[model samples]
Target: MDKRLSDYIKKVVTEHGVTSTLKMKLLLEVFLRQSIFVNTSLPPKHNKRFWPSLKDIYNHVAAQFLKLRDSCVDQKLVVEMVEEQRSLHKGERFYIRIKKDQEPGKFTDENFGMTKTEQSMKLVNILWEWPRMDLPINKGTGNIQGYNIATLFAKDIKTKLKEILELEEGDKRCYEPHWRHLQWIDRNDLTDHNVMNNSVKGMEERNKLFHEERWAEMSALVLEEFGLFKPKTIIGLFSPPGYYLSLKNCNNGKLMATLEDETGQRLNEGVRYFKDVLLVEARIIIASVVKNITYREAEELLYPLK
Candidate 1:
C-alpha cells in the first residue's frame, strides 16, 4: 500500500475501530470480486449465473456494511476502538488542516485515476461519516413473525390450504347457497355444479393456482415497496423447492417461446403474470408473519385488495 493511503487507513482504524477496518476489508474484497466480472464479457441477463457489475457489487457490499453499522456488534466495536484510540493518544493533541492545491486524486495516475483499494477506502470514509437513517418500525428486521417468509411459505402449505378451503366453503355455503349445492354434493348429477366443481382435487387445483399467483404478485409488490431487489430479498417469498421448480418451469416455457418466435410475447406475458402474482403473495404472507397478523390483515395493511 502507498504510505499516504496506509496512514489514512491506520487513522481510520484507530478512530473507528476494528469494525470499520473490517468494513473496508470487505469492501476491498467485493471490489476484487467485481473486477473479475468486469474483465469478462458479461453473460446474457437470461443466463442464471452470478455475474454482477462492479457498481452492483459495490452497492451490495455498501448496503451490507450499512446494516452492520446499525448492529450491536458494530456499536460495541466502535466504542472499543474509540477507547483504544483515546488511550493511545492521551497526551497527544490532534489537529486538522487543509492544504491548498491538494486534490483528492493526487496519489493515482490519470489513466488509472483511483485504484480499487483507494476506492474502497473512500467508500469506508463515506459510510463512516454519512448520516444514517433508521428503518421503519413496520419493516421489523426484514423478518416476519420470528420466521423467514420463505420458511413459512414452504412449511405452512397445509395451513394455507385449510384457510383458503374454509373461506371458499363459507363463501359457497353461506353467501351463495342454492339447490345447486345438493347437485354439487351428489357428484352424480350433471345438470348443475357448484362454483368450484365440488371436488377436493378441483378445489385444491384452484386454490393452488390462486395462492401461487397471489404469492408471486404479493412478493413482488412487497419487494418493490420495501426497496429489496437483491437475491436475499427472495427470502421474503417464503418459497419451497417446489416453488422454485415452478419458477424454473416458467423460465423454460419463456425460453422455449422465445425460440419458437411465435406466440413468444404472449408466453412471456403469461409467465410474467404468474411469477409476479406469486412473488406478491409471498411478500404479503411474509409481512403478515412478521407483523404477527393474518395474511388478510397483512394484505390490508400493505395494499388492500377488494
Candidate 2:
C-alpha cells in the first residue's frame, strides 16, 4: 500500500525522541491511510490502516504529542503566532490541531477560532509571564480562517503563564490577562483632575474586563477632595457604615467602584460587574490620597484576593 505519509510520520516521531509507540504509528496510519473529508468532490480513498486494536494507536499518538516542547519546536514561530492571535483581538477563542514540527498545522473549516466570551484568555504563554506582565485582548476583533500559528499562540500563552506563575490547576482566573495598563497610563498626563478621572475610568474598565484573579471584594477610597467624578453603572452590596458600592461614569468614561470602611462590611457590585467573584478578596490600588491639603498621590498597584 502507499505508506509514504505513515513512514514519514514515523520518522518524525523517532527524530523527536519517540522510539516505538503503536498508537502513534496507528494514528499516522489512520491520518494517512484513511479517507479524510476535504474537497468533498474528490473520490474517496477508503483504505483501512493496519491496526489490530484502538489502544495501540492511542498510546503511540499520546506519547508523541506529550513529548512536544520548546526544545522540539521553534520558539520564534510560536511567539509570532501568539502575538498575531492577540493582535486579532478575538479574545480567548482557539482551535486544537496536531502538526509536523517543521510545518504549519492543517486548518479545517470545522474548527471555530477562539472568542472573548469565555473571560479567560486560553492562548499559550499566559502563566510564563505571570507576576511580571499580562497581555490585554479586546473583544470582537476578527474571524480566524483556520488553525495554524494563531492556534499555537492561543495555546502557548496559557501554558507559559501557568508555568511562570506557578499556577495550580484549581487556581483559576476569570479575566483575560492584560498588559497594557502601564503603557496606556504612561501615555497620558495624570496631573489634570479630569485627565486623572478619565484614566481611572479606563483603569476600572481594564480591571473589570481583565483581572488576574477573581475577588469577591475590592475597594477604592474615592476622596471628595479630588473634585468631581461621576459614576458609570451603579450597584450596592453589604458594606460598612462609611462606604457604599458605586459604579460611575465620568466625562464619558465608565468605572466600577467598591467602597469599604472600618465597620468590616464589604461594598461592591454583587453580580452585575463580575461574572463569578467567589473568592474572599483581591485588590488593585489605582490612586490614593496621602498629603496635607494641597495634593494627592496616584499609582497602579496589584493585590491578591483572599
Candidate 3:
C-alpha cells in the first residue's frame, strides 16, 4: 500500500475508529478517481455523471490503483480524489426546497414548466443530494445480488454497541436507527421515475460493486495498518434468558471475535473458523474480552510495538 493511502487510513480510523471495509474501499476509490457517484434522488454539489454501473466504477478504480501501484500517481490528485469521495460517501442529507411557484416533479427541456408536485420532488431530491442508507429501499435486506453493505461508524462500533446492548432489557432493547440518513423521494415525481427507469438496475449493480470495491480497499488498509494481522479469538454477546458469551479460537488463519459472558466465561458458540469469513475477507476484526480490545486496537498497537 502507498504511504499516503496508509496515512489516510490511519487518519480516517482516528477520526472514526474501526472502519468497515466498505467505507475504506470507497474512500480509496474516491481518492484515486476524483469522482463521486451519488443517486440523483439526492443533491449535494455539481459533478458530471460518470459511471453507469458500480462495477464499471470499481473496475476502473481497481485498474487505476494497480497502474499506480509502482508508478506513483500524483499525490495531490490522490488527496483531492479522497476528499471528493469522502464528500460523496458521507455527504450531507439536505433536501432542495422547491419554491411555491416551482413544480413538484422533474422539469425537463420539454416540461421545464414545473408543477407543485414536481417542485416539491425536486426540492426534496436537491436537499437529499445523495442516496441515503436509511430508506427501506436502500437497506441491506433486499439485496438483489448476493451482496450486502456493512458500515461502521468509529464512534459507535467500538464504544456504543456494547452500551446500546446493555441499555436494552430483554429482546425489547429498542435502539435508534443506525444508518447515516434517510432519503426522501416523491413517488409522484417524474424526475425520480425517470432516474429509476434509467438507473435502478444499474444502481443495484453499482451498490454491489461499491460494496465489493470498498472491501478490497479496506483489506489493503488493514494489512497496511497491521501486517499479518489475525485475531486470536472472538466472543459473542447475547442477552439474559439464554444470554451467554461464546468464545472461539481463530488460530486457523481467520479473523474471529470472542464473546464473554457477564461472569467473563468464554463459550464456544460465536463466530468460529470459516464463520466470520466476511470479516477476514474484508480484513475486519473484533476485540476480545481477554485483551479488552478490538482487532483495530491490536493493529494500531503494532505500529508502536514495531
Candidate 4:
C-alpha cells in the first residue's frame, strides 16, 4: 500500500465523518490521479475505456489488497469473507441503505458496464469491505450475523497481535477486526446490457472458486493466530471429505490426515498419532454446511490445524 494513500485513509476514517464508501471513492480518485503520472505500469485502457473510473480503479485496488492480505496470512490458502466470519466473531449489526427501486441482481457493475472479471473482482472487494461474522451468542442455530467488530476481543490481545505484526493503529491488518460499512448507490443512468448476461454468468463461476480459496486461507490464519499448531496443542478438522483433498494438497505436509466418521469416531487406526485429527460434524449438510456452522464452531475446528 502507498504511504500517502494509507495516511489519507486514516485521516478520512478518523476525522472526515464521511461514510466508508465515499471515503474509499475519494481516496481512490486521489490515488489514481497521483499515481497515473508517476506509475507507468497501469494499463492505458481497460474494457475499451480510457482512464478507468474511480469505481474501476477502486475495485482493482481492493482485489489487490485482498490478495495481499491473504498472502500475508497464508500463501497457499485463499480466504474469503464467509470463511473469515467462521473464524472471527462479529461485533455489531447495522443496515446499509441501497437504492429502493434497484432490481435484485443489479449492482455497480451493471451500471458501469464492467466485464465479468471486473464484476467478480468487485464482489470479492465488497466481501472484505463489509465483512459479516458470527455473534458469540446463538452458537448452535448459526442464524446470528453482524457487520462489525466492536471491542469483541480483549484490548490486550489485539494490541499484542498488532505489535507482533508491527502495524500502527487503524491499519487494515488481518489480525485486527473492525467494521467498515459501505453505502451502495444505484446507477440507473448508464445502460449497457450487451455484455451483462455473460458478466452475470462469470460471477457465478467466480463466486464458487472464491469461497473454496477463502476457506483454505482463513483456516491457515486461524491456526497461526490461536497457536493451535503448537507441539502439545490439540487440533481438530471438521470438514467434508471433499475438503480433505484440498487441505492435504495445500497444507504443505503441516497437517497429518486421518479418517473419521460423523460421530467423531476414528476410522483409520486405533491410535490417533498426530496432534491434528479430522472429524466430521454430524449437523453439517453437504449442500448448506457453510451456512450451518457458527463462528465459534468454525474457530474450534480450524484453530488446531496450524
Candidate 5:
C-alpha cells in the first residue's frame, strides 16, 4: 500500500481510536474486497459478532422494514420525485438529506435550502475531519461510468447502517446467525453504476453530477479544515428541525450522514467497521430508501403495480 494510504488507515484506526468512518469503510471495500458491494464484516480489533434468534429476526424485520412495506407505494413516480429533489439540490455547497413526515408545526420552507445552518455547519466540519471525512474514491472516471462511487450511494450506506443497527437481532453487525447477517445490504443493490432505481448503477453511486472544479473544491475543503481545526466527536450528527441528510462519503462531495435523530445513538462504542461491513449496509440503505420498500415490500418495488 502507498505510505499515504497506510498512514491514513493508521491515523483513523489506531491513533484516533476511531475504527470506522463513512469514507474509510468505502476505501477498504474498493481495494480489499475489489468491489463496492454489501458488507457486514467488522475490524478484528472489535469484539466478535452475534446473531439474532428467530424471534429477534422476525421482530427486526417487522420494526425497521415492514413499516416501509406498509407505507411504500412502489411506483415509478416516487423514484422520479426523489430524483428531482436530488437534482435540484445537486449544486449546493454542503450536504443535504431527503426527509418527509415532518413533525407537525416543525416543517418550514424558510430553511428548506439554507446552506449554512449552525448544526449543518457543525456536522459539515465534523465531516471534514477523521472518521467523518469524505469517501476514498477515484474521480478520474466520470460519475456516470459504472464502478465509480456516487453521492446518493454513499448516503444510502448510512441510511442502511442506521436501519440495521436499530435491529433487535443484529449484533456487532457481521457474520451469520442466518440471512439477517446480510441485512446491511442486499442482492438488489449488486448492480453497477445505478445512480437511481430505474436508472441502474452500483450501491454506492451518486445521483447528482457536479462539475470537476466544484468537486475538486469540496474535496480540497477537507484538507484545509483538517490542517487548521481539531477533530470533533463523530457521534450524533442529526438535528431536529429537519435535515437533508447528505453523508458526503465519496470523493464527489455529496450528501452523507445519519438518517434520523436517534441514528447517532446507534453507533456501538468499540465497533470497528471495515470494507465488507459498510458496503453491505450501504446496499440495504439504498434499497430501503430509494426503492421504497421494506425487506418484504422489496417485491413491490421490484415488480410494481401497473
Candidate 6:
C-alpha cells in the first residue's frame, strides 16, 4: 500500500468516528488497487500492488470477508446501484444537475444511449474499477468448440441455474457478469434481480478459487504502516471468545498489533483449523498502530500457546 494512503487511513480510523464497516471498506478500496493475482512475478510493490505469498493472500481475503460479513451495509453506493438497476429496467432516463449554466428541461446525452450492460457496468465501476470476473456462461446457444460450465447450486450438479444469472445447460463461453459487485449479494439484495444477477456465480467461483483452498496453519496480520514487510504474529488475547493470534507464526521474533483492545484480531472460522493443522490464520491487532512486542513479552500475555 502507498504510504500516503496508509497514513490517511490510519488517521481516519484512529481519529475520526467512522464505523468499522467503513474502515474495512476503506481497506478494500486500497486492496482492489493492487496487483492481487498470485500468477504475477513482479516485485512486492515495484511501484505497484504487493503481498508476500499465498498465505498472505488467503489471510487478507478471509479478514476482509469477516469484516464485511459482520458489518452493516448502509453504503450510498449500494443504494445507488439498486436504484439505478430499477430505473434501467423500467426504461427511464436520468436527470443530472450540473454546476455550469445548462439548458433546463433539455434532455442531454450525458447519461443517455447506454446499453443495459453498459449502464449497469457504469455504476459497477464506482465500487471497483477492475475487470469483471469472467465466468463460463452457458448461453444454450452456439458455444466455443470446447467449453463447459459445471454447477454447484443444483442437486444433480447438471441442471442449469436459471434463477441465478440465467445460466443454461448448453453451448457457452467465458462471459463477464452483468453485475460485478459481490458486496450487494449479502446485503439482502437477492430479491433485487439486478443486484443479484451474477453475484452468486461470482461467489461460487470465488469460493473455489479462495474459500476452498487448503490451510497452511499460519496467520498474516496485514497493515499499511508495516509497508511491504508482512507481519506474521500478534499478542494473542484469549478471553472466552478466543481473541488471539497463533504464537507459532511469530518466527520473526516479534509480535505486531494493529489495535489496542485486540477486538478485531483473528481469522475467519472458514479457514480456522484445530485437529491436525499446526496453526490457523489470524490478524495482528493490539496496542496502537503496531507494537512489536518481543517474544518473551508476547508469551507472557499469550494463552495456551499454540
State which candidate has the highest TM-score: 1
RMSD of every candidate to native, in Å, equals: 22.6, 25.6, 24.6, 23.7, 21.4, 22.8
The stretch of ten residues in a row with the least summed lDDT in candidate 6 is: 280-289
Score candidate 5 by lDDT.
Answer: 0.33
Per-residue error for 273 in candidate 1, Å, reads: 2.1
Q: What would you estimate as the lDDT of candidate 1? A: 0.34
Per-residue accuracy of model 2 over 197-296 as CA lDDT, tens digit each: 2465545644543344211101111111111222222221111112222223222121221221211113122221211111101111111111111111
**Candidate 3 lDDT by residue in tens digits, 192-229:** 22233245454443343335344333332322222221
Model 6's alpha-carbon lDDT is 0.27
The 0-to-1 C-alpha lDDT of every candidate, in the order given, reads: 0.34, 0.29, 0.31, 0.29, 0.33, 0.27
Candidate 1 similarity to native, TM-score:
0.22
Best by lDDT: 1
Global fold similarity of model 5 (TM-score): 0.20
* Candidate 1 stretches greater than 4 Å from native: 1-142, 157-267
Q: By lDDT, highest first, what's the ranking? A: 1, 5, 3, 4, 2, 6
Q: Where does candidate 3 stray beyond 4 Å?
A: 35-233, 236-306
After the best TM-score superposition of candidate 4, give how far the Cα of residue 120 lies from its true spot, in angstroms. Answer: 34
Model 5: per-residue Cα lDDT over 1-306, one tens digit each = 333334445544433333223335444434433322237553342322222232332333233332343221222224445667778898654433324554422333233234445435444434333343344435433332233334544444434444443343333222222123233322112122112224333211332333343333333332222212211233221121234322222321111122212332233210112122333334334445554567434322322222
- Is 3 or 4 the stronger prediction by lDDT? 3
Better by TM-score, candidate 5 or 1: 1
**For residues 71-126, could you state the per-residue lDDT of candidate 4 as single tens digits?**
21222122233445655756644333334565422432131334544533333333
| Sequence-dependent TM-score of model 2 | 0.17
Model 3 lowest lDDT segment of ten: 179-188
lDDT of 4: 0.29
Worst 10 residues of 1 by lDDT: 236-245
Clashes of each: 29, 38, 39, 4, 37, 4
lDDT of 2 at 92: 75
